[model samples]
Target: MSRSPLEKFRTIFKRSSSNSSRSNSTQSENNSLTMGGENYDYDEPPLTPLELHGYKSTTKHRLLNKELAEELRQHVPALLQISHDWELLYSIEQSGTSLQTLYDKCQPQIGESVNRRRGYLIVVQDTRKNIFGAYINEHLRPLDKKIYYGNGDCFLWKLEKGDVKDLNNKHQSIEKKEVSLNLKVFPFTSVNDFVIYSNNQFISVGSGDGKFGLWIDSNLSIGASDSVDTFGNEPLSDRKKFYILGLEIWKIC
Candidate 1:
């Protein structure tokens, strides 16, 4: 049967509309599967670093919680009879403080004592309020040189926070779920610049940039001769930027 041109156009439009509807349905189903459920909406925002790193509950707080701090302290052993009572060395409420400034403040604490090795701990709170820290087994000295190395015991750990009640009753009041330690010295420089601790002392920590590297006595000193310490071929600026919430230098007194 010969149909009018207008009728043919109407038929084509109907077929196109049906195909479009089927395509949209298929896409919606695919999206639902990707999102983990049909009820999940794609319009919802993505998970932030804090949420992803298990800091969902305390992300809003600028200061680190006591429970979490205690948990982090557990990882640092009191080597050579050093007390667990950590003393502060330096801090910056905001960014833009030079590494040299921190070193100057730390110098007096480190002292000229060759008899007792000093251990240092640096805790930084990022903009997201996620707390991370590192430990240096030896006291950092003001150096005329731009680099120093550390022994192999240096490592970094990320504090994993979770609901204490979820674990066994033994962990009832503890919010720290786990401490993920990376023993491998982070490859920061071409030769892995770090402080070498003698007398059986060692420490390590994750940098502000989330990389593992030991604290070095390079350009950090007030009168460091070099313009910048060579961390491999990378610029000093490539190094991690941290807002020092707290710095502690503990001597084996």
Candidate 2:
């Protein structure tokens, strides 16, 4: 018999925890990991496995509902999809509209994070009513010497409202609007590794030939998206350029 989704979920997490335990001694040899010359101690704790249906967030979020979150979890890289609950790190409406505030508020304060590994999920809604964002492998922060962070596991995505054909009780064909959760994910193509670049002025992801796959301004009010060799993605917004109506970041903890 085929295993259920819950069974598969448990198996994946069980495998991850098992691997983490086997590698603990090897990983613990290095007491400190350096990011921009700043040493951060690794607590080196084992992975904490959650319950079976652990596809929920610790705090509520305006964008990316449970259904969408669960679906997105299914599509992420295997290591990132480990059983974990999300915690709202920052919100443009709640934390204010400044990009600097976003960077400041998104800094990970939880020292118990095993090996200092965490994932950030960003969701943005443009004035055109299109929703899009990225699954970042690292927190949003200013990099020294303008160096970029994150890796190929990071990706971009967009949400759209769509309809499909349906039939009513009378057997008449009709249009039924779906859940408005039509999601398109753009994974890394590995053409160029310009994954994430941030500074006091702006934050950009996936860059090549003077274009960014996603670029947000310092005010967090305006941005642009274009095809980049890094992710080989199309423009994410309805228009090439878009004004942000809402932005939020959720940390997988």
Scored by TM-score, the top model is 2
Could you give candidate 2's per-residue lDDT for residues 1-253 as a string of tens digits? 9998656544433323223443556445354444443334445455444322312333232554555676678566656667566676777756778877788778767676668567788888777667788988888888768687888789998765321112111122222333445678899998888999998888998998999999999999999999998888878887888999778788774
What is model 2's C-alpha RMSD? 13.2
Query: Residue 120's C-alpha lDDT in candidate 1?
Result: 57
Candidate lDDT values, in order: 0.36, 0.71
Worst 10 residues of 2 by lDDT: 163-172
Model 2 C-alpha lDDT versus the unseen true structure? 0.71
TM-score for all predictions?
0.40, 0.68
Return the clash pairs for model 1, or none: 149-194, 149-195, 149-196, 150-194, 150-195, 150-196, 151-196, 154-203, 155-204, 190-232
Q: Residue by residue across 1-253, what tens digits does model 1's lDDT show?
A: 9998656544533222223344466435443322122132232233221111212332232233334444444445434223434444544432224455555555644446566655555544333222344555655544444344554444343333322222222233234555333221122233444433211122222222323233323232111011112222121112244323223333322
lDDT of 2 at 92: 70
